[model samples]
Target: MLQNLSSPSLQPSSASPSPFTHHSSQNYSHAKPWPLQKRPLTRLSCASSGPKRKMVPQSEKLEAEQLVRSIMWNMNGKEPVLKTLNKYVRVVRTEHCFLLFEELGKNDKWLQCLEVFRWMQKQRWYVADNGVYSKLISVMGKKGQIRMAMWLFSEMRNSGCRPDTSVYNALITAHLHSQDKAKALGKALGYFEKMKGIEWCKPNTVTYNILLRAFAQARNVEQVDALFKDLHESIVSPDIYTYNGLMDAYGKNGMIREMESVLSRMKSNQCKPDIITFNLLIDSYGKKQEFDKMEQVFKSLLRSKEKPTLATFNSMIINYGKARLREKAENIFQKMKNMGYTPSFITCESLIMMYGLCDCVSRARDIFDGMVQSGKEMKVSTLNAMLDVYCMNGLPMEADMLFKSAKGLGIVPNSSTYKLLYKAYTKANMKELLQNLLEHMDRDGIVPNKRFFLEALGAFQSLPAGMETATATTVVGSPLGRSKT
Candidate 1:
């Protein structure tokens, strides 16, 4: 069990159960928090209008970044961050602290982010502001720490800081991150309604963006429609993120017509399609195996001002691979290379899976070999991609051989790797091989937990075996395996 992973990315309603979601990819970058947009959908910040922030010079920004990274390396036996902060107290500024939150938040160190916040408060220059509380709430929310976020909201008020639109937005988004979908949805709506009566905390586009995504993912079509109607009647206008999040939610739920309806509404509102919009369209069509429409969208993307990204290519390759459109997938890869797009480990994994589906196991092996010999550190998933090909293609022996040699390649196998192998070995009815794998699992200190035992009763739903694929915090361009926009 990957307990309480703070991915914070939205997904289709588990209730909808789309076949497309069984694709089984991991570590995608598109899982950033809601309103996953590069541009500010609107000036929706709850930060009271203040003097313009002077841009930190590039040199100062780089210096601050280096300082944050150094503190993070924990190079000493003791707490380097607190010690360094005391020694270099002069450098302790709002921007630097924000950078600290970012680095710490990535590693699930929300408590440390709070420590830094406390340290800031102790400074003579520190001032309590809605922005600080909002940032902290957002960080806690992303970590699935809803109670902490609520406490922070209360603490902000106790500190004489008024809750603002931005603060409410963070609180609502945090609620959505909670495990109980029904409770989370109800609580988010409660906050949404509460924000309405507060004069200064009135809802903004960002607020709507967050709520719309929540309801959309909950499959509450009526509520989604009601929200949009309210948006039209209000002074706040919908933006790219608003439409993008809704469409993405619908698309993931296999509500293609609703997704398209969003596109039409978007055009009617004069909100232009950006890269996310195009990628979402491509992914939706690809999953439905509507090749002509997918290709048309790709062509349109090429004609647009926004260029294609690695995600764009990765999604197409995996989708084509799933359909066994081997040549088209290869052509896309070639085009990606010709466009000077460098394939990442993700792209390589997609390629491996693609080739496997095309019955070109040897070709898949060549790619995996290049990845191994590239001398770059490899991911377990990349190796699993090759292993998946072998296991899936009825070559458990070859997969076993690769698994044994994984340590030599500096790749450490995790539970997923074991799960994949376990499924394959049992499927092949190789008793001796299963015993060998058990030895490896025991040696590695991995327990074959109860659920894993349950899994033994069914064939491992290897990724796609069948079908198919974003990076970037804002998820600008590529759309294969992203969080619902």
Candidate 2:
């Protein structure tokens, strides 16, 4: 028989005695022969009561998240993550184990999730249930581990757990994560067709939502239309997520007219648009460079009860920057700050690039410097932005200086860094600097491919005839000649 690891017998006993326990032998007959004075009973009055402490209950999800974080941080012993997990598993409730598996799955620790699931199966409390298999399949599907998800389905059936609608839904989602998009869609359709014949496994709203969203993402208009037709024929009512998912997918693919049609359908169904719906519309319009439509959506969002998120401002700032509307981008950045949204790394990177593209190099430098002083971990993108700006503005000398300081600042130069510097040096016709860069590239193991040679030749061809031949031969030969046999 499987052991009950989390049983009360396995847990540690409490050290302290209960306060409610009575000492029966103690006498209290003459302890309080009180005075009969008529005093106002202040303690009994409602006004005299102290403020009640607000007890915010900890949810299972929060507890699971915390447990996963704790395990990840403290698993220092010479054992696998699963083994370390076993020690703690013996003390927590079964529900907590399920939650931990979910947390691990979300963090892409699929192997560890499998270990926990297997451990649960060995416990006496575990029974063959469709929910466990359904959830596990969903997790595996999310990580694109379709083979493992299929194996789980086979194992679930062997354990006498019959497949339900939720389980079928999980299987369809797993197929959607497959690398072959056409094959995945075909399998999903096959499952949908199979589900129709099984009375107990009739497709639910969730099933329809999944297939619709998948088809919309693939931009399979024909399949999306057919699915909608099937959905209308069914008794299941489509929820807000169903519409929202379709709209978001369509908007991402730049199908604005189709997205608007979905919005109209939503309104007709009496389903109110949520914050996500507005964010999607705003982002789509902005990406299409339709500023007027974007602004109209922004105004409508402001008027509606749904508050704007940081994503709302981020999308607007990035798109305006792309459109070269410097003033508008800056205005949106300022609006985000006024609304108490702290600038994230993405926010800083976007602003820096925007300012650089607009020839406002000084403003970009100020933002970079501010970020440095604030002690936030600088990302490579930030450094690359500054370097690109210097090169773009005919300040390669300044860019070289920045490159030298990068190592001291703990910022590592990537391939993009080398590419930018090489182009800059080649343009300036700094032969000695170009040679040094080649040596550095060789040391860093970044091999000069055909594309690199083509760019180098193009840059050299721009020079006078005599200089061009000599410089091109010298530059191309240096890296190849210096390479270790």
Kindly give the number of clashing pairs for every candidate. Answer: 2, 0
lDDT of each: 0.73, 0.71
Best by TM-score: 1
lDDT of 1 by residue, 349-430 (tens): 9999999998899999999999988999999989889999998799999999999999999999999898898788767766
TM-score of each: 0.80, 0.71
Q: Judge candidate 2 against the unseen true structure and give its global Cα lDDT, from 0 to 1.
A: 0.71
Residue pairs whose backbone atoms clash in candidate 2 = none
- Measured with C-alpha atoms, the lDDT of residue 16 in candidate 1 is 16
For candidate 2, the per-residue lDDT at 77 reads: 39
- Model 2: per-residue lDDT, tens digit, 197-298? 998788887788889988998988888889988998998987666777888889889998888878777766666666666778788889899999888877
